[model samples]
Target: MIAIDDILEKIVSKEIEKKEALRFFEELPEKEKSYLVSKLKTHLSNNANSVENNFSEKKERTLKAVTELQLNEEHKGFIDQMAQKLEKNAPKSKENASECQTYFVDQRRTGGLKKALKRLQFHLTYSECDGAYLYDIDGNKYIDIASDNGVNLFGHQPDFIKEAISKRLDKGYPLVGYTEELSQATKLFSELTGHERVLFTQSGTEAVMWAVRIARAATQKKKIVIFEGAYHGLSDTVLAAKDQFGNSIAMGLGMIQEFADELIVLDYGNMEDLSIIEDRADEIAGVLVEPVQSRNPNNQPVEFLKEVRKLTLEKNILLIMDEMITGFRVSCSGVQGLWKIKGDLATYGKIPAGGMPSGMIAGLTKYMNYVDGGTFDYDDESMPSVKKALMAGTHTRNPIKLAATLAILTEIKKRSSTSENKTDESNSCFLQELNEKTRLMCEELNSFFKTKNVPLIIEYFSSLFRFKFLDDPNGVVKELVFVLMRINGVETSPSGNCFLTLAHSDKDIKSIIRVVKKSIDTLMKQNFFYISDSIEEDEIKEDIRSTISTIPDMRNDPEQESIKNDQMEKLRKLIISDLNNFQEKEVTI
Candidate 1:
C-alpha cells in the first residue's frame, strides 16, 4: 500500500491526477484520509500566493480606484468632514470592542475592504436590540435593516421565542437527548416543507453537507450541480468558482481540488445553461439551487427554477433546494411552497430556527432513508434494511433550539392558516402584510432614485432586498454607500443585502428611506458621480494644496517630508493630465 504522505506529496506536486488521488484517498482508513486532507490543506495554504494572485490584483485595483476618486477636491473635503464627525462621535465602548477583536480571528472585520474600513473606524458594537432598531454602545440608535442575515424573521428579541427558550432552559434540557420538543419541531418542519423525513443539525452548512451526502448515496453518482452567484454556505463541497478559462476552481484556499472537480457551476438564469445539466445528467447526483440568491435578489427566475426541477426529475437527479436564507421568511413553506415546485430534498435554516443556530434537512423517504436505514418500529421484527449515510452530531437535537424552532413554526402555521382563509390573495396576513410593506418600500426607494437620477436601485423578492448599482457592477461604489448609510443612521450588511421583519413599522421604513436619500444627497454634493470638464489651473493648485494640508504632520522628519512632497507633486501632475485628457475627450465628442 502507498503511504499517505507519498500520496499527498504526489497530489501537491501534480504527479497524480485529482481523480486518481481521490480514489487513493477513499481507499485509506477514515482517520488516515482525514489526516491526509489536513496535510493537503496546509500545502494549499502555504502555496496560496500563486493561487490568490488574481484576487490580490483585483484588490489593488479597487484600492487604487477608490484612492484616486477620493482625491477629487470636493470628495477630499467631504471625507475630511466625515472623518472629523466620526472621530468626535466615536463610541468608546465600540473602540474597546474593536481593540478586543484584534485578539481573535473574525471574518467580519478581516473580509472585504478591511484596511479602508479600519482607517475609518467603522466597527459597530451594538449594546442592545429591540424590534427593528439597534442601539450602539454610545447610545446612538439606527434602524436595523441587516436583520441578522435573515435570521430575525419576527425581529430581535421577540417575546414568544424568548419565552420558549427560557422555558426550555427551566426544564434543564440535556445537550443530547430525545425530547417531546424535538418531535414537535421535526413534525412542524415536515408539514411546513412537505417532506416525509427531517433531520436536524447545528447550522445551515451542516444541513447542506448532509443533503449532498444523501443525494450521492441514493443515486450512486458523484457530481453535484450548483449555480453561479448563489451562496450555499461554507462547506467545501459547494465552495467552488469558475475561472476565466471556464474551469472549476476552489473559491478559497484549503479546499481540495478534487471537491471542485466534482462540482458543475452554471449560469443562474440563462436558458442555454440547462443543456449542460441534460448533457451531464448521468454523472450528476443532484442539482443544488438557491431559488432566490441573496446577492442578486432581483433575478427570481421562477421559470428557470421550474425547468431545472423538471430536468432533475427527468434525469433521476435529486433536486436539493438550499433555502437557508429564504426559508420561513419568504413564506410559511419557503420558495418551494411559494412557487408550488417541490424538490426531492431541501435544506433550511435561518428563520426556521427563530434566531437559534440550527439547520434542517428534509426530504422524501426514498432519499432521507439513508439517514437511518428506513425507520423501523419496536413492534416489528424487521431490522435496519437500507444503506445508511453518516449524519450525527452532539447537539443535533438540543431542546432549546427545538423549542425555539417549534415556536416559530407554530406561529407561521397560524399566520398561514389565516392567509389561506382569505378570499383575496392580496388580503392582509402576517407574511403577506410584511411582503407588501417591503414591496412598497423598495418601490418608493427606486422611484426616488429614478427621479433624482442617482444611478442606484433597490430590488427585492418578497421581504428580501438588495441595493444594486446601475453601472457599478464591480462594486466600486458599494463600500462608500454602506459607509455613508451607516453614518446617516441606517445599518445594513456589507454586501448591501437586507431584510424586513414584522417588527419594522411603517415609520421605521420611512426613516430608512430618508437616511438613504440623505446619504445620496451628501454624495451628490461631493461630486462623487461626475467630474467637471472645465476647471481653472489656480483652482486645481488650490485643491492640491488643500489635499496636502490634510496629511499628518512630518515636522520632525525633514528628509521624509521632502520625499513625500515630491510624490505629491507627481500625483498632482498626473491628476491634471487626466483632467486635460477628459476635457479633450469631451471636446471631441
Candidate 2:
C-alpha cells in the first residue's frame, strides 16, 4: 500500500499537481480513499496555510489539471468538493484573488494580524454572497452568522432589495441630487424611528460622528461621556479607549490625544459611572451609549438605561444613543422605544438602509436643524447660527441607497406585523420572535457548558448572540470559537456577536448550534482549550468523561457525534448542552 503521506508530499513538492496526486491515491478502494482523505485533513489542518504559501507557484497548474480532466460528473463533484474545502481551509490565497487582495492580505501580513488569525485557526476569503450564505473564493459555502457586522440582517440580496435596485436602475441612476427615492427613504426612516428629522451619511460611523458633533454644538460643551466597550464610530472623538488604570486615551497614534481627552470613558451598566455624570454635569455635552453594547450585548440593564435618561434630563446634558447596531435591529423604534426611554439624539445604520451602505442621525428639530445648513426654524429653539455644525457627504442621500432603504424598511415593518397607521408594541412582532429564538439557543448552550464543566457561556441580547469562555479574560477562547464556527460552516464576528435576521429559519438556527457544538468538539480533540496554564490536563480529561458519559460515544453517536471521537466526550457534552439550552430556553421564553 502506498503511504498517503508520500502522495501528499509529491503534491506539496510540485512533483505532481493535485489532480494527478488524487488519481494516484484513487488506486485504493473507495473505503480506503475516504479514510485516507480524513487522515490527510487531520494531519494538514494546522499546516494548511503554510502548505498554500509553499505551493503558490503550483496553484494554477493544479487548477488547470482539474479542468483538463474529462472526468464523470460524480467524480468531478467529489474532486471539486474536496478541492474547495482544502482551498477554504488553506491559510493563504492571494494569487487567485478576484478583487484587490489588500482588503484581506494587507493587514494579514502584520505580526499582530497574523497571530490573531492563527489563534482563530480560520482565514476567510469571500468572493460572493447570496441570501444568508457566503461563497468564498474557493466556492465553499458558509452560513453567514456575522451578517456583515449586522448590516445584512435580511440576508444577502433579498428579492425586495434587488427589485428596488432594479427599479432605481431603470430610472437612470439619479446620483446628482435629491430624488423622490431619497425623500421617500428619509420619510420612512423618520416614521419608523419617531425622530423628527434625519441627516443621512455613508456609514454608521459617520452617523455617530455627526451625532457627537450635533450634541457638542447644541450643548456648547466640549466633554462627551461614553461607556466602555461601546463602539460609537471611528471618528476621532469616539475612537478613544480606556487604560487599565481607567484613564481615557486615544486608541491609535494618528488620533489627537487632546481631542480624546474630551471624551469621558465610563463603565457601562455601572452606577458609579452615573455618579461621574452627576459630578461632571456642568462640563458634559452628552452621554453616548449603546443600549446593548456589541462587546457584551447581553449585559444591558433596563434600570441603567432609565437611569441614563433620568440623569441626562436632570443635568440638562444631551443624551446620544449610538444605535448603529440596535437601530431597527431591536425594534422599529429601536432600544429607546423598547425600553420606554428616549434619547435627545440617536445615530442609526445597519438595517436602517436595508443592508445598504448608509447611515443617519435622527433627532428633534432643535439639534437636527443645526446640521440642516444652520437653519433653526423651530418655534422655541433659536441658538446662535455660528454654533451650527456642518454635516454633508457626496453619497449622503444617494438615490440607490434611498430606494433600497425604503424597500427594506417597508418589508421589515410588514414582517414585524406593524402597519403604517397602527402603533402596536413592536416587541410583540417579528423582531421579538428572533430575539426569543436567540435567547433560547443561548440557554441551551449554557446548560451544555455546565453539564460538561466547560467554562463557557453563550449570551443572547435581543437578536445578537455571543459565546464567552469565563476563564478567558483576554478573549482568545472567544476568538478560537469564532474560527471553529467558520470551520463548521458558520461565520460570525470575532466579538462572538452573531446577528440573526427574519431570514434565518428554524433549520438554520439548529445548524448554527450543531456546528458550534462540532467546533467545540474539534477544539477539545486538538486540546486547544488546554492553552490555559492554570488548568491541569488530567482534570480536563476527567471533566470531559464525566460530563459526556450520559450520551453514547460522541464520535459515533448518530445524533451527537457530528465529528471525530478522539476527544468525543467533551464535544458530546457540548452538543447536548447546546441542544438542551435551546429546548430549555424555548420553554422559558
Per-residue CA lDDT of candidate 2, range 1-589, in tens?
1344344434332334444554565465433343343333323331232224332343322111111122346533443454465454643543444244546564323211222233233345788888778888666688888887888777898999999988988987656667887777777778778888888899888888888888888888888988866788778878765532234666554667787778887778778668778977998999999988887776678898899899999998999988888777778888888888889999888787776788888888888877854454577777456445777788887888888888987887677664333454552366777778878887877666554445566666778776654432223344445655766788776445678777788988899889878766654554444322222322333343344444332221245324433333344345335334433432100
Clashing pairs in 1: none
Stretches off by above 4 angstroms in model 2 are 1-122, 244-246, 373-387, 417-424, 473-480, 530-589
Error of 1 at 25 (Å): 34
- How many collisions per candidate? 0, 5
The weakest ten consecutive residues by lDDT in model 1 span 60-69
Q: After superposition, how far is residue 387 of candidate 1 from its true place, in Å?
A: 1.0
Report the lDDT tens digits of candidate 1 across residue range 404-423.
Answer: 99998888877777655553
All models: lDDT? 0.71, 0.65
- Report lDDT (Cα) of residue 573, candidate 2: 41
